[model samples]
Target: MALVELPYNQLVQWVIARGKTPEDCNKRLIAVEELCKGFFEKHTSIPQDVKDMQRHVHCEYTEWYEILCDITERLKSTEDGKKVNFIGQYSYEPLYDADKILRAFRKNNLHIVSYSQVLQKQMTFNLPFIKKGIESNNKELSDYKARRAESLRKLNANINELQNRLKVYCMDIKDYPFNEDFEVCLKTRLTQEIAIKNANMTIHNYHRTLKLVEALDNEVVPVFKAFVKYQKMDKNYHPEETMKHIRQAVKHGLEYATNGNEDTEERPSDDANAEPEEEPLIQIVKDDNELLVAEDKRRIIFSTQLGQSSFRQLLLGELLELLSFVKVRIDELQNRSNAANYIFSQSGENVNELIMQPISKYEKYIEVINEVIEILSGTDSMKALSILKNRSDLEKSAQGEISIWKRCCKEVAEQSDLDKRIQVTTETLKRFTSDLESARKTIKDTKAKLEKATAEVMGSPVKIFGEIDNI
Candidate 1:
């Protein structure tokens, strides 16, 4: 049976209707079925759609394929052609029109072509040209490498020659001994010659020469002096004269004079049976025995002096320590005082209102007393004496009452109890007005006691005591 070609629209409708309904409803169903069967058979046997799509896709692909193949073939056919071979292989120049190719394929409903197949086709055309180019490049690269290697070898030879020359120069210089003056001079002259020969001699070379000279002065000179001294001492005869000779030699080298000519005086021969002259009393007094006794006395005196000096130093150290502690305490107290003063000043007529809840007058006094006690406890006897002296000076100062008033006022401001504050303030003001009459009396009593103690210690009256007692 011959197959008739149905339009896609009609075929789709017929297939849809056949799927939706039974054949008995329409008499044309049988004819439609018979036509459909023949149509399917022809379609399966010779798919015109598929063949058309293939033809369109193949045509489009062939254009690109032909161009790449032509370029590759042309490149491979020439001597310098391989350098351009990648134009066919990896190049995507043709694919620049990918959108057009895609549209054409879609218009024909063509099957999609693979990226690998496109690349393979490109490489197939490109390989021959690339191989030719690679061969030519490899030959040129080999020639260049050979030339580079030759140049490197020549450079290495020149470096080796220079190194050999340097080694010879070093050996020649090393042969000159530093101990021999002549060799040293020769080396010095050689160095000068080298420096003169070099037009670009640097400050660094001068510094190196100075360093060498310093080394000779520090190490070589001392060793040479010691060696000469040792040789002089090593001679068998004249043991006493040896020392004299060594001293003279050292003096000559150092450019100094000997102490005296006492060593040069002649002594009597050992075989002479002569009695020694009797020394005078003055001579006896100035003899080594007397000198030794005097030296012993001087040593005892020096030891006693050192002990007294050390005692004085110890006293000074203690005073310094006491002063430092007092200074710190005074600073702390002054800060608290200033703070209290500030609060009082700011309160202004309402000084009672400027109360700090946590801090109290008694507590502040305790703190101050504790600080004073710490300082007093840390102080040595010498510091106590120094403090007593300072207190004497402070007693003489007219500002003492003012200082006490200020301290008392600070204490008053810190008080929490109003009654106690008023009482303490009144008492403090009274004491200030009285200029510490009781404290002065107590200090007078202390002065008497200190005088008595000093008299007992020294077994004599101390003149300062009379002055303090009068105070």
Candidate 2:
């Protein structure tokens, strides 16, 4: 359901019905009412936010970081060359260079949150209320894939495909081959005058015949019938091509040996006391066109993941300015509230009116967000990549903080309710005690009256009995 603006009364009732006391409810009422009224609907890209960044960059703070310095330098550059084009008198922002760098990453599948998407996020968080739930609604495919892990079969398939691709990439790009070590011994021809050795691989003087022994390091390397290594001693030799062959051969040697034309079926154990056989690992290559894409996911996971973090950090930096503004405004309101409370306290009138105030925070609405992405730049892709790596941990921390906050609110409400119940119980006990005392006093007075009446009758009764005896 769409979240329309709820009235103050509705918010009050909503809070109160959830075990919150009226005083506590009033404290929360303002925030929820404002939310329902679209007070926070304005995106961080407002002119005020821009101005605040301008002001912050202009000021010289001792604690300014390296990234902040670069950003401020960009801002200061605005004063020098604020021109987009000579024909058009377009101006540059202090963050103009940074903005240019940010745009360069558009081809990256990173989400650049616009001012409008910020509003959409509000609705996105309400996904639990959506019709499709989480199976598939509007979440990006990349986001879904990033969060979920591949199944064992899929992962094995991917590993197999990657191994094959490496072999293909090496052999196809250059004349690099599956290089291996060969245990070779010289076969010498004992002639009458001169002795000659056979050429195993390297071309040598008086060496012609080449013979191959069993493949050396067969356990570690694939059991190839023959292996080739090309090495040019001339100035035309390329070290990069040579290194690629070496790296690929070493990395995928075991993989090729395990899967390349080997019997994969498990062998039956003949001896019971023999060492337990390990579970055989089999890899299946699937025909998936998705892997045919030009984008390299491995590179993205390691190095090319700047776009998302840059977008995130940029949005965060913008929001910090807005948060700083809100913090100041809230502080002013709090000071005013304190002054009003002090005035009320000075009045000596004895009254039992409840005067509970909600806990006043001087800093941020969500404190967890304050520590996120302090000062990120588009230039440092490494830093951005690092931020992307810790996405899961950051998510956990935020969710945990939110969960703790919800628990704390619920506890506060419960405590308030408990105090109220205890007070009512104490009052009932006092009234019962007072009534018991009054009843006791009345019982004592009636007993004294009965005693007096009995005594007076006794005093008269003695004479009556004497008169009867005389009669």
Candidate 3:
């Protein structure tokens, strides 16, 4: 009886209808293998005129049946990358015994038939769909890069303007009204620039991620599929050379995906647990004769000291936090001093109001700064250091401030600081955008090189499989 040729959709249904339990599939494979082996033996003793027909039947039974068995095994194994795919209401869990159908078609050596015709038909419909899916990802990657580039360009232009403004402020403000205020402005701008740079870096990372997606669609996934295809061509092909190429292609794909620069060298001893090369023991010259005979050993002295602190309840951790607070206060005082000096330098009517008035207002902050400096400068002992290191909230740690003065100084400093910070941030964003653009180009070039290398590796099958088939 002739089997009706099924379309891809109908073929999936036919296979689903024939699906069996994994245990049943395994039993069926064993029986089929035994029956094929028995039939091959019986046919070998036949006359030469009939042997050609027998040989063809033997190949079909072994080849298609063996491949079917392998597919069943894959369905059982969780690690298998490919398995019988089901559509709509069909389930793959019961495991389809497509091998049983092929074995039946072989008909115990009564006829020669190619069961692969069904498989070829299914693949013919599916391959173009797979290729189209991969192409869609590549198109998405191209669109993403274009949009990102435009955004980066606009950010760069804004930064350039800010950078120009900062330069003007620095060069022109040699003798300005409220010098401390002017200095505060400069510091604020510098901080803004740093923030913009960070934002640029984040965007660059996003761009790198997209590039990796593109590589997977264009290079890595296709190579992986090729490796699977080669294995399927002949189960016995076991091409070690092809596998090596596959591994290399996968590694290249991962590197691109992770935004890892290939120029970085690998170090085996990067982990702390890695053993160091054995070094010659240090030879102390107890005797002159022994010293002369022994190889010169390099002596490295590593020392650790432990001491009891005089402070009874002080933990080093708590003490460190207190020290941080003191340091922060000192920095604040120094910045105020600089802002005041900048204001004083200007020969203007408002110098007293801008610089001197604010200074008088923050007298308590100045006094705290003096006291902190005196205490830190005096302390050299563990006990003194421990006393200073105790943790407390910065606001409540040292309390002696008139609210009005604090507010007045804060307002003056912020007015100057904000002006500078805004310009600086713009420049910073621009600089980072430029750097991101350069990084993007480098990544693009790296991906291209990787693609070329991958293509060359995949193309080696022409040389590998060419002469071997004839031999």
Candidate 4:
């Protein structure tokens, strides 16, 4: 029986088996079926009415049949044709209009064709080259997928391990936070927060990188492959041909490549009606460089602390509150020293000021805390943080756990990963202090104006917009 006479499904299976891997056989079969159905539907003249087709009176069917058969044979054939074992001994014979397959070969040298108009001037097609190119893309895509999966596995493992460690840490400290229902001290809380936040940030970075990788594999790469398939069909089909027009009509199609599914088919063009001067099919090699660049970009984003701004902001807020609490403690100590000095004076003895140095140090920290808040609220928290690191006290603290709270605060502030947050904190404080100074000036000016208005209005006794002392 002639190839055209074969059932559509059987023909698709035959074509797919010729060149496609068994893994993708089912997927390609579905694609071929959709392509064929779409082609037949559009070229109703070729298939004719069912009754007319059944009557075997129309010659259009023959042309259409030949085109389909040619496409199938081209898809299945190797560059240098060779006999291969199937269920039985079979050979791929180039069907009529085999020259149309040149389009497929043209796709392999897309970059060249795009660069050189001279090459595209000639109607040249190399089938074997196209086949090799497709195989190469498949292999690379496969390899990338493997690597991506491995990366995801490792990232997930790290995240899980960190989570487990955090869980254990929490359990260990759960009872250590207090004795006899006493409130947890800031040092203990700060210590736990610092450790937890560090782990959480690492996990966040891994998750973010993993997501980008998934996007490349699952979204970008598939789209790239679909474009290749479309180009393969584009060469043979003329943009003006009924089948091509039909395919293009449904360019945003429900079935086939239009659906944006990996399993969907590529769009087909009609070679017979295609313009001779039209550009040849070109394939864009899915660059491994693109993937590598994306990975590098991901690393940069996480490295600079830009990727998790929201989380860092929350942490800064916590630090600000803790610093405020520290300031209050300093104030209390200062008040106690003042009281002690007064008592010593009453006893006719002098006492050196205690806690004055610590109080002064904490006052400077309060200023830093204010600057950090200001930086976080600004447009460029990262830059602010980076610049603010110069004035940071986190790294200036004396080494060693002199006190539980001091150690925790020092560790948290000095942590390399948290340096960005400290910087942001200081910057925020600077901004807030500036705003506060400006507001103070504004308030002073307003008070002076109010007093002046009161004087002028009382002298006039009938002016509007002035506060009356009685009211």
Candidate 5:
């Protein structure tokens, strides 16, 4: 039998008349509307031009029409009472099978067949070989796992060494009387070493031998957990009781270190066989004084370190600001230079007049001096002082050469005996303007480049520290 094509509304009506439930018909209608709306959205803009003949529907429309047709034909052929079961049987069986296959593939096929066809092919021709391959793979995996376990053990050892070194360093620092300056120096050196060590780890990860170094850096938490577990196994203290003590110690240390106060009152101590009660650590008068002094020194050291860090940050910020200003000035100079160069290149009366010439030409020597001053001023005070001294020395040697050019231009103007002197003055002005413009551009571009390089250099440390904090 030939299937008759009907518009969507008629198809919906036919399905309803065939005795399917209103809910089923309504669902299909909603699907149709969504499909049509989505099709139009994908293929054509809203309020499309009537004159545009090439406008067409997208994939959703075709999909919806096919689905509706299939459903409608199924409804028409099935007995009225059995229509629902027929639809369910035909539509659901393949869908359920497909879903099962997908779930199975996701769970079991990590390294095996990646698709249905490949899975089928493997099962058909290579089932025995595949089983042997799995056994071989299992053996290799076991070997690799053993190697990884050994590597992890070595990594833990290295971390333990580093932790010991850190502990020793901290003890040494703690034993000494507090000096803010010395603390600052120690912190700076330690921080720099940390930075270099991190950089080396990143670069060294390229080699297989050094792969363990990267692993060592990453093994902190696992090793710490293992150490805690070992301590628990050794039963020096009950795991829960030991953890409580550690927590208490850390809390007391933070409080005493930050607030410079120690509770002198004593309470019950923990006994394995007896009931435990919370108590503060023992406090002595000398210990209180030492703790308070140490806390104060730490605060001072931190404040000084913070101040130095802030000062360096501010210096970089100022340098960046000066660089931005220099860039703007350079751009203005370049535009002026370009204009002057353009004027000189043109062939006309105005060209001879040298109109729009850079201001630098009339004051070439002065312009160069001003450029030197600007460049020097843009630097930090100490750097500026050095630059100024060097610039002064350079100016002395170049002054005579500059004067000769001035004399030559003046002599040419005098020989022309032109009444206006506008041409010569304008020409001279143009050259100076161009020089000023070029100098400005050079300074601006150089500053931007320097700022970019500095940002790139500092960015890595900031990012690394940020990641460590997050970790």
Candidate 6:
């Protein structure tokens, strides 16, 4: 049977199976059936009105169609073959008309092709994608929303369980954690301390370097320039001119030292007394990680005096200290890795309780949430999420406990694998170490130049930047 002859439902199913939406399939099917019915009625009806068509007593009303088909076939087989339009100066060379019948019908105003062809282009058609029996786009989207809601439901529950566990531990946990039950907890706690310290030291050193750089520009060189000007010594010597260039170089260097990036804006403050500020959020940014992951100790150091900075040095002094801080952090993480390895190896075949035991019920709890985020992975539901945000200090309070468990767990259910994290951290540390001695020579040269200028002005050489007790 012809495709147009199929039942209405069958046609809809066929169209739908070819990736058309159910709504589209049903609408297009109704129109196709109407067009096909009209076409059959005209093609099969007796010719009653047109005198030319009525005179053809050849057994059918549409006899002109068969005659045209015959004419088209004979023309193609003979020298009626497609030829260039020599009438147009042969401008269409090699692009001769392929269908003589189509143009012939158009020229004579006699078109009786497939009836469906007239309105077919008005509708949209799609190729096959998913299998048949799938629901419409609206239904599928609704299902996704339900699944996403369920996932969030589970996510909140798991986060709640994590909060409860941490609360219980914090309320009852000993300061030293002398109990064997807390041995694992103790190690994670230590890891938190180390990370926070490392972060503080990095910021402290960075700011100190900025201060020293600023001192060179604001205090040291300005004082030297004044002394040179007061002495009226430009006639014989022009060391002040050299100092002016140094002042300019220091101004540019200050930008790099403060922000740790190319931007000239001031660095984000890490001081305890500074007003709290939030990182600006994009309206459409909605990654599961934005609210899910706990803040590590490194990020926490900015608000506390855990890493305080108060020192002076040459232009690159902050760069040197930052590198030094990274070295210490790497050493600490390496030690923690070794400790983790030892904890794993201590039990032999029986296995250590500290290594094999569940850190808390939160592990299994988070397991349920693992698939929830994925359900919403392709969704924008997170844009309106405030489950974590609405609570009072929940995000901040959970940071310590959540961060500790992360360091303790070798395999977090939905997070990055522990081994991979260690490998990446180690590789990064190696890169920093390779360039450790970079500014040593530059600082040495800068100090010699400064000492000579100061001695000529004040009889005694002054150490302008490094290890000086006074500003």
Candidate 2: worst 10 consecutive residues by lDDT?
187-196
Off by over 4 Å in 6: 1-176, 208-216, 227-266, 269-471
Candidate 3 structure lDDT: 0.33
lDDT of 5 by residue, 133-155 (tens): 44554555455455545545554
lDDT scores in order? 0.32, 0.29, 0.33, 0.34, 0.32, 0.34
Q: In candidate 5, residue 448 scores what lDDT?
A: 35
Give the TM-score (vs. native) of candidate 2: 0.19
How well does each candidate superpose onto the true structure, as a TM-score?
0.16, 0.19, 0.19, 0.16, 0.15, 0.20
**Number of backbone clashes in candidate 6:** 0
Error of 4 at 465 (Å): 78
What is the model-wide C-alpha lDDT for candidate 6? 0.34
- Give candidate 1 misplaced runs (Cα > 4 Å): 1-103, 106-125, 171-471
Give the CA lDDT, 0 to 100, for residue 69 in model 5.
31
lDDT for each residue of candidate 6 in 66-160, tens digit (9 for 90 to 100): 33444344434444234435574222211122133334433322231111121121111110111111223334445545554554555455555
lDDT of 3 by residue, 1-471 (tens): 222333322322333254412223334445665554454354343333323333444442233444444444544553322444555321343233333444463343211112222233223433334444445544554554555455445535534444454453232222222234544443433323322222222223223323433433332323233433433743654433333322332233122111222322221122212222333223212242221111211100000000112111122222233334334434544687675345334434443333343433344433433432332233423222222222121112112111222333444455445445545544554555554454344334333332332233333211111111221
- RMSD of candidate 6 to true structure, Å: 41.0
Q: 371, model 3: CA deviation in Å? A: 50
